[model samples]
Target: MKRFFTALALIPSAAFAHVGDHSHVAATHLLTEPDHLGVIGVVIVIALGAWLWRRGRS
Candidate 1:
């Protein structure tokens, strides 16, 4: 659907938006790394899928 595509399109921008010189012991690796970004993509997809699933149930 159009809404799904819209959310997909926004994923990359939203992923990078979290990067703003914030230091953390939790995530030692840099966010700009390809592997880190890929992990973020997977997490985003999972989160979006969960959200859509819950929304549809309600």
Candidate 2:
């Protein structure tokens, strides 16, 4: 019974062990998709604008 509980406790961790396996797939999609590129560009522009705004304020 103790061993059974220990195995059950480890079941969730074992299920999560593959979580990092798909990072490259996300990177590949981001690099290859024009929509993602546009989103990234917009984010970069916003970040740069904020930085410039802060710099001017100081």
TM-score of each: 0.49, 0.54
Model 1 lDDT at residue 46: 75
lDDT of 2 by residue, 1-58 (tens): 4664565565453334333454457677655666556656755775687678779999
TM-score of 2: 0.54
For model 1, residues 6-41, the per-residue Cα lDDT tens digits are: 776776754564555555435546566676777778
- Which residue segments of model 1 deviate by more than 4 Å? 1-29
Q: Which ten residues in a row have the lowest lDDT in candidate 2?
A: 13-22
What is the C-alpha local distance difference test score of candidate 1?
A: 0.68
Candidate that would win on TM-score: 2
For candidate 2, the per-residue lDDT at 16 reads 44
